[model samples]
Target: MTGKEEPKEVRKYLQQSHDRIFENNKKWAEEMQKKNPAFFKDLSAGQSPEYLWIGCSDSRIPAEAITGLDPGEMFIHRNIANLVCNVDLNVMAVVNYAVRHLKVKHIVVCGHYGCGGVKAAMTPKDMGLLNPWLRNIRDVYRLHQAELDKITDEAKKYDRLVELNVYEQCRNIIKTAAVQQCWAENEYPVVHGWVFGFADGLLKDLKFDHEGQLKEIQKIYDLTKDA
Candidate 1:
């Protein structure tokens, strides 16, 4: 087909998809209101979430659905491979806001097995814009190279990398000043690492030691001087 003709067809399909989303949203809103008359009112008033969820931006893994959380129950931040880096303004701002303002009691860094970002990072090639972002996962592999090298099965190796990525990201969050100061002052927002598996739809907690990891990280990245 000609370029103009193709765009017309694509636009029609996208319009249909967009309309379907709003239709479903309207129905969902009606359902919520029916369940609780004050649902929308309470939601509009404000959100004081108890948990901050950091997870991969995979469409298959809906953090709220997997964790059985309501909309206002968890503040969420998602990125490719679920990475947490000091240089990333977006995630950094999210962490700071959640810890400082929201006072979230728990912060979960969740990654999933069979993640496209992790798989792409594993492949040694130039992925253009993705190279820099995926490099974080490569760093995770490098950190656990000896342990990862022991696994002969490629699938197992990939799975291990995903879990390790979550763990490292949790450590990264711990290294943040907002988290450190908040923990020192309130002893909350404990960081947790979790991995979601496609098969059987279960989350595998890596049993992150919040206080222990905080102490380990504070040896270098301590910022709780006032607290």
Candidate 2:
């Protein structure tokens, strides 16, 4: 009954939870080996994924599982709300490497309808250090305020915001020099915006027009002209 000690049930649960991860890892490795004897050897060599996925760091949605992509098939970068900020070196670095080195054919920005990050941005409160990160979502709301304001239901409005956030992030990716220059020369790395619905466990394609959007963006943010 020490105040600092955890209960026996809690300790037992913690131990089992920690042990299960290794147990599952061993089982998964064995299964992979049984399917493909060279799976580990191939995985250890290098990765050449065809797709770059920027998605929300939500535990409920596993990108590869939903898309039926195996390991090394997709390069994934996850954050609170799947934002692609110009000043964020981390996401920018990933985009640069994915395009320049990996030469991924598709770049996807996927958000979800019931995202906690988007919901927090919708709320009028200070979230300490998260304010800057969530402000990107708020900016998305501001840009589409007219359309969002007209919606009568809050739930529908939230869903719309999530979709719009994904759209804006996709636009951000297209604005990058890595994507623009690569597309100009190679015509690959098509950008897409998708929203995942937890209710149905399905992804909804926003059908982002990569070529059309690029044409419009290059009118102002053109980086390939000099390249």
The CA lDDT of each predicted structure is 0.91, 0.95
Supply candidate 2's per-residue lDDT for 179: 97
lDDT of 2 by residue, 7-39 (tens): 886787779999999999999999999999999
Alpha-carbon TM-score of each model against the true structure = 0.94, 0.95
- CA RMSD of all predictions: 2.2, 2.3
Q: Which stretches of candidate 1 lie above 4 Å from their native place? A: 1-8
Please name the candidate that would achieve the greatest lDDT relative to the true structure.
2
Worst 10 residues of 2 by lDDT: 1-10
Kindly list the per-residue Cα lDDT of model 1 for residues 41-81, writing each as its tens digit: 99999999999999889999998999898989999999888
